[model samples]
Target: MFKTIKNDLPASIVVFFVALPLCLGIALASGAPLFSGLIAGIIGGIVVGSLSGSKIGVSGPAAGLAAIVLTAIGTLGGYQNFLVAVVLGGIIQLLFGVLRAGVIGYYFPSSVIKGMLTGIGIIIILKQIPHFFGYDANPEGDFAFFQVDGENTFSDLFKTLKYITPGSALIGIMGLGILILWEKVLTKKAKIFKLIQGPLVAVVVGIIFYAITKSNDTLAIAQSHLVTVPIPEDTSSFFAQFSFPNFSVITKPEIWIVAFTIALVASLETLLCVEATDKLDPHKNVTPTNRELLAQGTGNILSGLIGGLPITQVIVRSSANIQSGGVSKMSAIIHGFFLLISVIVIPKLLNMIPLSVLAAILLVVGYKLAKPKLFKQMYDLGWKQSVPFTVTVLGIVFIDLLYGIGLGLGVGIIVILLKSYQNSHFLHIEDKSNGKHKIKMSFAEEVTFFNKGAILKELDSLPRDTYLELNLMNTRYLDNDVIEILEDFAVKAKERHIDIKLVSKRGVVENPESFIEFFRTRPKSNLSLS
Candidate 1:
């Protein structure tokens, strides 16, 4: 970890800048205290990082849980009650780790995962637009179809256009331009810009701009565009920010429901991040899924206990970690430590950073995740991959993240089934021997119920008086449905004066008496020939 630190410190700084605003934004979206998000970020980085087996993955407060947290708070009666659910959710995730359910992440198709990332990228860009324009009526990270204010996503964007504040918009544009310039040109120039990070520079410029405009009341940006950190007047007031759960409510069924909701969503998000971070890792390190779950579980438990939002291994933070040159877990740990120190020691200075400047930084991060090249690459993979990928992307953009992924996974499974059905069997015809046409039907490996229709159709199409050879030597498993169809075809073959040969591990039979009974003689595996 120390060796990794020397090489990754620069990247860590960049990740720190990238993570700071997102932590606050997610907290705001969850309707929890702003510091709660920072707390999660710190714990996710420091605590989870130390426990995680992943070399490159970074953990943080995720946007995906914002809606769940918001509703859970209300449903559970208060934020403290929601903390109980989060802690329980963490315990549930730990159980998942112990049960080795982490392999579930590997089963998802690559197309669907890509779609998820793209979808999330688009959502980030969309959600940040309002912040860029200084119309922050909704919280900084809300991305649901319907918002707490009763307006839908598109409606909020349209509403923002009509009420754009000049100072905020101008500063936002300037910040974005500076970010772009830094990435495209300044960062490449070692003499002048190597020592300074673009996001840090953009933030400093925004603060200066805000201070300059403050004197001219007409040109001033509203408080909405500025970063809002709760300023406690004294040590006692700061400590009072921590909330405790009413454990008496734990008996209520609603608490269990909320706990399950958090567990499910948090687990899914963590799994997805594990897969994504594996992809992003320069060394192509495979993170142990179960270990990741355990790490996340521990982080969430700590976060909940400390009045923080639930923690997940977030792709956004992980991607930033990778891009920032993080090679080991130390960078993640340091970033978390940075979050803790920033809030405790210099929160006022943190609040001086403009929301628009942060939006600019995220815009860059979003583009990296959903680059046009990714779309082109997926398109080249053909419709089987591209269709699901596009569907997931659009679903995430128009709907929600989980919905989009579910839709994509459904489509991907259908495509797999279709391909399997297409390749399940092959027919060959040879010259007639002794005045009968020789028909050969070769079955594929592992024939399941999905191939029943196609196999039956092929058998039914054979001509009368044909000499048929039904091969099951290559087939490992024949589902009961296909076995039944084969048995029915055998009776029809005899009636049609067709000669049928059944080939299996056992000697060939002229005409099987009973398909199920013949196969019963042998050990019952996936495949049995009567």
Candidate 2:
């Protein structure tokens, strides 16, 4: 882990900057104690980071769960009650890991995955625009289309025009300029620039700008437009931030329902991040998905016990880690330590960093993710890939993260079925074999119920008094549904005076007695018949 400190250390700093406001913002949005977000972020970075197999993915309190957390907090009676649900959710996630439900991430289409990344990128840009211009009515981490602020994503843009702060906007613009110059020019000029990182420099400069202009009225940044780390005065006050879950509430059926909801949503989000971040990793490391759920489960459990929001593998932080040149999980762990140390040592100092400056940093991150080239790239892949990709993007922008993915996934399934229906079988005809029309139909490697219609259509259209060769030599999986279709066709073939010959890797059969009976001797998935 220490081997890549040169790369990981600077990368961790960038992730720390990216994570700070997000923690506070998501906490505020969730209607939980602001400190709870920090606790979750710290645990996510430290505990989940240590346990997870992912080298690049970062975990934290997610904006995606803000609505659920808010509602559960009210419905479950109180914040303390919600903590019980969080703990139970962690346990449920652990079971999901044990059951290997992490494989669900793998089944998502590549188009949908790419769309997710691009969609998130677009959202970051849209969500941060108001913050960048010094209009921060909505919390920084609220990624949903309809916000707790009672405004939608686009409405906030107009609101920004009404309430823009001059000083905050100035620093934000400068910060963005510095980031662009550092990344595009300064980093190439010297080693020190890369070591310091652009986002860290932008944040420091924003703080300095905030400090110097404090006395100026028109140019002064407002308290609302700055990072708001809880400033605990004494040691006891600092420790007082932690809250324990009320285990007595665990008996409530409502608690169990909330727990299951958190478990399912958090686990799904984590698995998606695992897949997305792996795609972003320059090293191309494959994260062990099941282990990730276990890590997340453990992190959530610990976080809930110590007064924290539920945790998930967060793509924004993970992508920031990767883009900042993180080489291993050490970066994530180091960032967690940074959060822990900052909240303890310099909460006031952190509070001085203008939110707009962080918005600038995120703007760049967002641009990198939603670059114009990806749209055309997806489009070039054709509608089969592009349709779901487009749908996912639109859904994310107009709806929310999970809903967008669900919509895209639904479209993706339809595309798959269409492909399956078309590619189920191949046909060839040998002219006049023994004065009969001789035709050969070869099934695809894996024929399922989706192919039932196509296979039946082909068989029904076959001329009477014909010789049919049913080839399964290359097939590996034949669904029971398709087998039944073939069996019924075989019985009808005798009356049509069509000679049926079945050929497979096992052996040839002429007028087979029962296709079902034949495959019954094989394994459940019919692997042995292949």
Candidate 3:
């Protein structure tokens, strides 16, 4: 791992800059103390990164969990009680790992997974736009369609347009320009450029801009637009910020509900991130999902015990880590250390960095995730892949992340069913010497309602005086809908002078009362078409 330092160190620096604002923003969005977000980031990086099996994935306070955390805090009567649930949630996740439930992540269709990453990319860009313009009403981590403040995502954007801050907007534009120059120009320079990253350079320039603006009242930016790290007056005051959980609420039903909710959502988010990060990795490293769940579970427990919000393998941070050239887990671990040391040692220096600078860093990340090439690539894969991918992108953009994913998954499943129905059976027609046509129809291994359409089409297309032989010898399960369609076709066959013969493992039946019931009476056997 240490051998990756050359790449990991620079990547870690980039991830650190990207993570700073997010840590504070997630805490703010959760309505928890601002320091709590930093705590989660620190723990997510250090504890989780050290334990995680993922090579290039980064963990942190997730925007996906903001709503759950907010509600849990209020329902639990205090943030401390919610912290207890977080810890318990982590324990549950750890148990899930031990139980080997992490394989569940593998079951999601590829289209849905791609949709998720693209959707998250769009959301990150949209969420960061306000920060880019210095509109701080909504917290940096609010990604839901409906914000806790009662403003929907679009309404919030309109609000930002109405209340843009000049200082924030200017700084943001300058930061974006600096980043663009560093990437498009300075990066080509061998010596100095390779030594520093664009995000780091942008941050330094933003700090200087902030310092210059701070000296003049007329050009001053409000404190809200600046990075707000909690400044403890002294060591004692700093230590006072950490809140311990109220374990007395451990037995309450509400605590368990919150615990289960966190465990389920965090695990799901982590699995999704693991899938997304694996795809993002240039080396194509396949992360061990079960191990990742165990690692996340342990990390969440630690985070909650130490007064941090729930942690997950966050896609935004992970994508940023990958884009910044992180090759190993060391980059993630080091960024966590950066979060820890920055808060304890030089929070004032951290505060000097502007939010606009960080927004510029995320802008690059957002672009990389939702690049035009990705869209074109998916489109080229055909409608089966493209439709779901498009729906997912739009759903996430116009709705919420989870809802968008669900929509994409629904579309993907429908596509699969359509394909299955079309391919369920094969029909071959032959003209017999006896002045009749022999039609052979073969059924698939498992026929469901989805296969009914093609089956009906084939049945209805049969010509008069045709001798049809329906084969179900390989079929294991036939759905009720398909059976009904067959029954209706059998009845209509007599009128059309169609002679029907049924063949199965049991034997051949000249005429059957019920297609499904006839099969039910047959001896059980392994049925496979192939």
Give the candidate number with the greatest lDDT: 2
| TM-score for predicted model 1 compared with the true structure | 0.94
Question: Residue-wise lDDT of candidate 1 within 1-530, one digit each (tens)?
Answer: 78766646666676777788778888888889888988888899899999999987888888889988988898889988888888888999999999998999999999999888888777778887887888888776677677767887788889889978778888889999997888789778774574466766788889999888977766687676778767788889989888766777889899889888888898988998899788878899999999999999999888888798998888877887776567888888888888778777878877777787777777787888899999999999999999999999988888788888899999999999998898898998977888788988888878888897788888888888899988878877778788778777877877888888877766677765744456656656535543
Q: Flag regions of model 3 displaced more than 4 Å.
A: 432-435, 460-464, 471-497, 500-525, 528-530
Error of 1 at 51 (Å): 1.2
Q: Give one digit per residue, the lDDT tens place, for model 3 in 1-530.
A: 99988888889999999888888888989989888898899888988899998988999999888988888888789999999999999999999999998898887788888888888787778888888888888888888878888887778778889878787788889888888888788878775776678788788888888888887766577888888999999989999999889999899999998899999989988987898889888999999999999999999988899899999998888988887778999999999999899998999999888787788788878887888898989989999999999998888888777788789889988899889978899998866847779999998889987888899988998889889999888887777677778878878988998888888876677764554456555444532222
Q: Report, for every candidate in turn, its global Cα lDDT versus the true structure.
A: 0.83, 0.93, 0.86
lDDT per residue, candidate 2, 360-400, as tens digits?
98999998888999999989989999999999999999999
Native-vs-model 3 lDDT?
Answer: 0.86
* Candidate 1 ranges with C-alpha deviation above 4 Å: 191-195, 432-435, 514-518, 525-530
